[model samples]
Target: MSKSCQGLFVEFVKCLRESDCMKASVEHRSVTECAKVSEECAGLRYTFFRCKHGQIDPRTRIKGNKGY
Candidate 1:
């Protein structure tokens, strides 16, 4: 069986919701703050990849940076 997270549909759905909320609220924070938080979250890259629930979210990225 694939260890990929694509199987966890519910988790993918929840990630979508949180991404939306984060995107919507992003404008409320300063660029510096966004960068700080984004870095903090990115630090959890290993956990995100191991999620086996959902992949990393673009909206969870910095406000104006392209994703890797």
Candidate 2:
């Protein structure tokens, strides 16, 4: 990847690690809503991304299907 892309990847990983405390709340919300509240793909963005893409696991606390 390009230097900028690599930097972003590193930042993303750091951000996710830093946000490991926020658990996903189960609810029902559209991708539009998730995008509205997401901290720019950092903390809960990954959870919402999984929800939007239908890849979230229902068994976890982050049942991301909700308005996370």
Candidate 3:
């Protein structure tokens, strides 16, 4: 991915953290997989990912924010 896209993902994760929207027991998954599954899981946005080799990547967005 390009640097700008990576930066966006990081920022999105940071926003989730700042808003307390991420889950505690979430396991890291690929960005592609996360994008696919996020819609199915309530309140679970793509926070980050780790590849088979343990490389870390992150993606983020708000979920289950019914009050706001």
Candidate 4:
């Protein structure tokens, strides 16, 4: 993981931890179950994805990465 995306990753994890899906997953000892309700954190996920993609994409590098 790149240092630039770490903050986004932390935000995404915090969002996940706040969701009901994650609470239930913790109760059931199943982590993957939270993925079903991931839409709640879609925006953060997309931003993180873009940040990671930008690291390897020449066009994004030239154009400048989208800011959070």
Candidate 5:
């Protein structure tokens, strides 16, 4: 991931930690919508990336369908 994308993910995690409503609300939005909000809040352009199973969930032994 790019630096800006990493930063946005960090900020999104922080927001999830700070607000109970945010977590619940985010579930209502699609993944793309969530990424758009994160990018806009961080003042960065969004880029879509794919993550294989091990790259995302290390605990998972199976590998497939890990993109968002």
Candidate 6:
């Protein structure tokens, strides 16, 4: 991951650890059922995704990364 996206990545990981998704994963006792579709983390995930994609996209590169 790029340095610009690291902050968002850290935030996303923190959100995931605190979210019910982690609880569900614990309950199931398997990684296969782990779901990152939680409502709270959705926007963070989207922002992180956009930031990462922007790094490689020329058009977005011109517009600049909207690092959050």
What's the TM-score of every candidate structure? 0.23, 0.30, 0.28, 0.70, 0.29, 0.74
39: Cα error in model 4, Å: 2.1
lDDT of 4 by residue, 1-68 (tens): 76778899899889888877776665674545564457888888788888999988998777666645
Q: Lowest lDDT 10-mer window, candidate 4? A: 28-37
Query: Whose TM-score is higher: candidate 1's or candidate 6's?
Result: 6
Error of 1 at 25 (Å): 1.1
Q: Report the lDDT tens digits of candidate 1 across residue range 1-68.
A: 22343344344334444443356774686533543455334434334355432334455333422212
Q: Pull out the clashing pairs in model 2.
A: 27-66
* All candidates in order of lDDT, best leading: 4, 6, 2, 5, 1, 3
Q: Candidate 5, which ten residues in sequence have the lowest lDDT sum? A: 44-53
Among all windows of ten consecutive residues in candidate 2, which has the lowest summed lDDT?
A: 16-25
TM-score, model 5 to reference: 0.29
Task: Give per-residue CA lDDT, model 3, range 1-68, as digits (tens).
Answer: 53424554565455444432244325655444544544443233432322211223222222211111
Question: In model 5, which regions exceed 4 Å deviation?
Answer: 21-68
Q: What local lDDT does model 2 show for residue 10? A: 61
For 1-68, candidate 6 gives per-residue lDDT tens digits of: 67889999899878877777677665554322332557778888888888899999999788778776
Residue 39 displacement (Å), model 5: 16
Per-residue error for 61 in candidate 6, Å, reads 2.9
Cα lDDT of candidate 1 equals: 0.42
Better of 1 and 2 by TM-score: 2
Instruction: Predict model 2's lDDT versus the native.
Output: 0.45
> Stretches of candidate 2 above 4 Å error?
21-68
Report lDDT (CA) for all predictions. Answer: 0.42, 0.45, 0.37, 0.76, 0.44, 0.76
**Residue-by-residue lDDT tens digits, candidate 5, 45-65:** 232232222345555435433
